[model samples]
Target: MTPHRLGIVGLGVISAAYLETLAACSTLVVTAIADLDPDRAAAVARTLPAAHPMTVAELLASDDVDTVLNLTTPAAHVEIALGAINRGKPVYGEKPLAVTLSEGRSILAAATQAGVRVGSAPDTVLGTGIQTARAAIDDGLIGRPVAASAVMVTAGHELWHPHPDFYYREGGGPLFDMGPYYITALVHLLGPIRSVTGASSRPQDHRVIRTGPRAGESIPVSVDTHVTGVLEHVNGALSTITMSFDSTATVASPIEVHGTEGTLVVGDPNTFDGPTSLRRVNDVGFHLLDPLAGYVDGARGIGLLDQIRAPRRGIARANGELALHVLDVMESLQRAASQGRRVETSTDADRPDPVPLTPRSEWLAVQH
Candidate 1:
């Protein structure tokens, strides 16, 4: 098969990971690079044999590009996605699909009308960490999954990120920035959320940058710094989640799922792979489970590969519908917190088909 040409639209911190992973894959090729800063795009382009720097508009309309990789910030997600869609190109984007549920819906609606595929990230769920735990649940080791808890805590991004101002913006709070990984993993392990109830707080009005060149500068916080919520899944399972930028640290497992006869301690959802442990009701202690499913040694760009292969496989695991649903869940949670009432989700996405154990050799091999 011919390699699918990709036009990458952002040159942020996350783009490096995607570039590293895609460079080794034969099924995809970087054809164009674009960013808000021309020099950055040109510098990145100099390293790639086939990629050339282009303006965002030029890249979106370029005939050499078969697909668009929308890695711009949350605020620009809708604009970039719509630009690609209008030009009749399939698009794979970073998480939250868009900052607002309405913007997310617009992306999907445009894709449907354009007859192009839409894919979204936090594809970490498609890796061994979550998939192995998913296999355990399906094999009845945990019997019937009844509940789950996901926790993410940190002092805030300002300590490390060079441009940390976005973290406190409307689309960049703890719940929006880091929540997709946890929530998307929950959807993969459990099911789609039907409703949500939440309570949130913004403890600090301003935060001091501690790491970058702007170390002593302060950034205003416009969104919630801490968020706690309960998600009621369509299958009747419940998941409690806590996402916070105000907390320092914790010993809690990133995620834990309880079932009729056992409990599974899942690895961090943000990572591609980690340890998954299981403890039966009668067992002396938790036992580490071998990797049972998913892409081995997977990384960021694997989801885009999955999307490209969806034609032959019949489904895309890290798809736009799932991303849109995850976005809806987050938006609904925020609404529930503000209104002090349970909010039902306005969107739905079926649990994607579980990934079977797939080695790097096989997954990375060029598909004919």
Candidate 2:
């Protein structure tokens, strides 16, 4: 099979992981690269013999590029995606789809009109960790899920990220930056979100960098740092979510789902493989379940491969519709917080088909 040619835009921190993962996959090939900084793009190109650096405009117009990978920051997601769509190229991007739901909708609309595929991240859900939990739910092991809790807590990214300014801006925040992973996992385990009610806070106006050379420098926080919400799933399950940049620690499981017959502890949705445990009504404690679904030892670009496989199948698990729904759930949550009312979500997506356990060796051979 001829590998799908991918042109990558943006060489930020997240791009490194995608490059690493794509390097090992025979299903996709990185043929071109671009970044705002020419030097950075050249540096990335130097590492891949088949890839050459180009201006963002040049990369978008390259004949060898079949798909554009938008790894740009949240604010640039929509612009870059629109560029790719106008050029008639399929797009697979990093999460949040775009900074806002309106922008996200525009991207989808353009792609639909252009008749090209669209996919997005939080592909971690397509990994063993969350997929295994999803399998358990589908198998009736949990027996009618009732509610779920997802908690993610941290002091702030300014402490570690060298350039954390974007994190506090409109597109960035605890809710948008980290919410995709948890919410996407919930959608997989339960289903599409129907409505949301939320409350948010920004306890501090300014944050000081702790690491990096700019340590002690203050950055203004324009968006809420802490967000708590309840997402009503279409399946009638209610999921309570807490995403914070205000706290330092949390002992709660990353995610836990309760059902009539049992409780399930899902592993961190940000990771490919972790522990997924379950406890029945009569069980003394949660017991780890065997890995039952998803790509074992998976990595970031697995979603891109899924996209490559979609034409022969259908929509990839990490698809544009799912990303749009996740975005709708989040945007509604933000509005709910500001308006102090429950907001009905405008979009819905089907729970993607479960991935049967695909070991690394087998999944990698999907190139054919």
Q: What is the C-alpha RMSD of each candidate to the true structure, in Å?
A: 0.9, 1.0
The TM-score that candidate 2 achieves is 0.98
In candidate 2 the C-alpha lDDT for residue 184 amounts to 94
lDDT for each residue of candidate 2 in 15-130, tens digit (9 for 90 to 100): 98998888887777899999999999999999987899999899999999999999999999999999999999999999989999999999999999999989999899989999
What TM-score, computed on C-alpha atoms, does each candidate reach? 0.99, 0.98
Candidate 1 vs. true structure, TM-score: 0.99
Give candidate 2's error at residue 207 in angstroms. 0.9
By summed lDDT, which 10 consecutive residues of candidate 2 come out lowest? 359-368
- C-alpha lDDT of residue 251 in model 2: 92
Best by lDDT: 1
